[model samples]
Target chain A: MFKRGTLVVVAFVLAVLLTACGGAPAAPAAPAATDAPVAAEPFKVAVVMPSTETDLAWSQAMIDALRSIQAEMGGEAAMQISISENMFNVTDAAAALRDYASAGNQLVIAHGTQYGTSMFEVARDFPEVSFAWGTATDTGEAEGFTNVFSYNASAEEGGYVNGVIAAMLSTSNVVGIVGPVEAGDAKAYIDGFEQGVLSVKPDSTVNKTYTGSFGDTAAAAEAASTHIAAGADVLTGSAQQVVGAIGVAKERGALWLGTQSSQASLAPDIVVATQLYDWTGVLKDIIAKIQAGTLGGTAYDLTLENGGLKIVFNSAFPGVTPEMQAAVDTAIQGISSGVITVLP
Target chain B: MEQLFTLTTLTGILHSTIRLATPYLFASLGETISQRSGVLNLGVEGQMLMGAFAAFFVVVTTGSLLGGVVAAIFVGALLGLLMALVSVSFRAEQGISGIGMYLLGLGLSSLLFRLTLGSVQSVRGFAELALPGLSSIPVLGPALFKHSLLVYVAFALVPMVAYLLNRTTWGLNIRAVGDNPQAADTLGVPVIAIRYATVTVGGAMAAMGGASLSISAVNIFQENMTGGIGFIAVALVYFGGWRPVGVMLGILLFSLVSALQIWLQLVGIGIPSDLAVMLPYILTIIALALAPRRTGQPAALTRPFNRGMA
Candidate 1:
């Protein structure tokens, strides 16, 4: 209770509170002419996702990419990451996005299309803060915001490849596409798949159904069943709830191709290939740009040539033939060279 | 588009109907029991979620599908006890309490899944068990006799629930307490005890519906996986006029129209995809408008009974 003891105690309490608040790490003083000192601040990225990180679809894809990036770039101490997941409600998501920027995060990724308005609004308030979002190609340039970056994938390139293989393997000459909604990447993938099937066999009919929701497993399963009953020998879909469709396919002994993330583990034998959305390189580039003072204004498109739109063949699939592999490779090359335009 | 009524297509539609109706059947049947006892447990969705998570976790940890189902039932019963405590014993506002229960179930299930499972993973779900001899009988066999054990349980509960709510002495007391609790109290029927029993049964059955979804239908568990289907089940309770047979009819109509809508889209039938997607909901609303005013609803539904006040 002495006066000197009280001064030390108060100073200790304030330091603990500040650290607990996660205030920006105090920049170490310019070493005072010390040797072997690193001057870089930790690169922190905060993400607000619409679904759980374990969704194995859109949200999971980003999370997996972040974790891999974290490990590759010298782990958590060097690169800090925080996530607010299951933000399906826009109001909560907006609050979280604002909170992250205010907390002094170096980069914030609002990982959903529905978040565009909130993200832009929040981005406007913090011009110096870096923000990213999408399944979109716009960087908010028309709005004159340089701190917002967009990323979209050419999922059709992989979907087209899947359709080619599906048609070749199908005896019924029918492929089914189960989609969550008929917009954005879902539409692009399905459209590409239809054309890919027709490219191999002009008579091949690709039936597509949109379940109206990304998380409706029951609906997805029902759609898969209807497609199978209608004589589809192969099926493919993108989104989180395609797990249900894949389950039905595995049961009926039908082949399945997946996208958004690898679904091979869900059904090893039946899953032929997955359009792996490898955003790792893109994410790394974004981080590097943020580190280099280019907060935003650049949008990244994942295409075949960039090593982002990869067709990951499941080793467990027995349906693959040497001829089918050759055809898929040719389609990839044609797509990369711009010789083939996938039209649905 | 023109030749829509082939035997093969009809059978396929019928099969789809049965598959889609399982969750609805379980949920509505469970809700019916609670309403029959004068407790409007609008927490069926929450109960279903708790059940789904419990079932999923148990199955993953122990590798026992049966254990997963029972765990769901156990969780449901515990939650029902919570509901009974809040509404029956405490006599809180039934509507608000029911909603609170719903939110609690929703939040806890999601939190638990993230904590325990860490990520979405799949377990070996219940396989379809085609009944011997019966599964071979032309179109009907493949459509009706080929389903998982959970499907049979859901369908079987219809008759069992009918008999329980109508025939037994306990059923008589439930109806009595639900209609006029003061009168039942005068007649020496334990009103509070019967309410707890009925709510617990309702919760367990609802949880079973959720388990059926994860373990049998979808074969994987995801957050918000029930996707408001529990709310639909509650609607079915009113649509079915609170009768087991009537509820069954409502479920069949819902699943049939749902399947037919998807089929229409596939066949390139001229209906706009947006309108077609809304077929089941539109049909449900239409049926409700055309139906009777009071479809055997209990006289004291959602009313908490206090002995001293009465």
Candidate 2:
């Protein structure tokens, strides 16, 4: 028994040694994806979004725009959209940047401000791929950082449009905004929406409730219901999954003005129109800059005049008659043509 | 106001209770059995998180609800075996090792989920399963019969667990080991093996509870999505008098409070929605404070057994 145990131990050691020796030679240390060779290849643009594609709201709109832009450009440009949900983890951001950069992507567009720093760092490392961030904050200064830019929407302007529609359509002169949170980035929209609503109907009492979450549909629904019960005739929100809020409005038969995307189809009767952000145009212009070789490393803001932000009213909205539509069209034309300016 | 107590409300309450309790029922039963065998597995929460992540990812990738559930159970059992190895074999502090297991599971599961899923915004969930013959019945149809298969399994496991703990030889060995490990060891019962087996079974059950929530109840997994269900389930061991039947009743009661809160919100009851959302946790706290502590906890719980102690 002792001899057998010793023989078994020896055999195990020999087996391990042979297995180690037969293993393939160590591969060379590969270069980081961002540091890899970048030659004249298909223009690679990466869309780093805030959420997954299944969200069916802001994230989806961006996806649809990129796809439409791709389709329109006859599939000549390669646009890859990577989505992350509530992922503020620096490691995750770095990994995504590394992967995209390694793929020789010359242009990386981060849709949220949270990803800005990591994207910029990755861009600095590569120094070849250009990085653009959609942000509500200013990018401090321009330097050897020739590849980082920040962009923002005219969200306050969008709020103004929603306010106009709500004031015109409301029966009770009581409007409400179900905001996600009451601080920071959302505060601008809240103040702007209030200004917009009060501008159109000075007597309109705009009630506001913060659902404290951006993705809790149940919470959003409950908050919307509370507003409706409190005598708000028109409802709006800056919340993602604002569709749930729309559902509440539809259930109560109240008018709702849209937020990020054209939510008119969610409830045609309730959703009069959305303060639409044409992300498609934004993406196309970005791609155009890349093609024109004029792509700056600084963030770009496209607004109503630049065809990036505007309100789109559905044909079926009750208060939007031919006259109302023509007036809105005239306003849009004036804004676009620099005949009128809506300031934030 | 009076309509809140009507038939629709009561039925809704019951329905909601079942949904909320399903995860708890499975987890508490596992804990009960583990405790009954002189093992206190504190890794229930971590096991649950892993199960939730596993089931969510599987369901999303395969588009197979059933596949997700099976995978969750399998992964859960594998985790259970790991817990058993450290606590039973090495004779380490079961609590510490269990906690270590939990941390490992939690970190690993979250890492894997982010790597694969790419942190997408939302995941599509499984639809409710309405029973053919039973679902058509009034009142009970939506409340009891029309729930996910996991919910049914949760309830069914109650009686099954009760019977196993009371009537069987294996149950007898478990109780013997838990009550007097040295005495059981003298009688040729492998006390260590029995304790490990019971604890492992408990871990798997907890995993199932977690999976039920991810794959059946919500059908999507989010960060920290178990939302303290595992801790609540662990607390439920005290709530249920550390017995299968008692655990089921406790789970059902807690779930009832949850459902009541939901119903109140649906009807626009004059209450703060956040307060209503907090009702279940409040009830759990109350239950914990009100329980007769001495009678509920097992005599040998969290204490490792040694044959020489006899």
Query: Number of the top candidate by lDDT?
Result: 1
Cα displacement (Å) at residue A216, model 1: 1.4
Off by over 4 Å in 1: A1-37
Score every model by TM-score.
0.93, 0.59
Candidate 1, pairs of clashing residues: none
Q: Which candidate should be chosen as best, given DockQ against the real structure?
A: 1
Model 2 interface DockQ: 0.07
Report the lDDT tens digits of candidate 2 across residue range B1-310. Answer: 5646777656656676677788888888988999988788888888988887788788778888778878778888888888878877777898798789778876787678768874433234455578898887887786798776788888899888888888999998998888878788899998988987898788788888878766665545555556467778888888888788888888888877766665565455667755776787898888878886657566677778765864
**lDDT (Cα, tens digit) per residue for candidate 1, span B144-165:** 9888999999999999999999
Residues A47-77 of candidate 1: C-alpha lDDT, one tens digit per residue: 9997877776788889999999989877887
Docking level for model 1 = medium
Query: What's the CA error at residue B307 for candidate 2, in Å?
Result: 3.5
Computed on C-alpha atoms, the DockQ of candidate 1 is 0.61
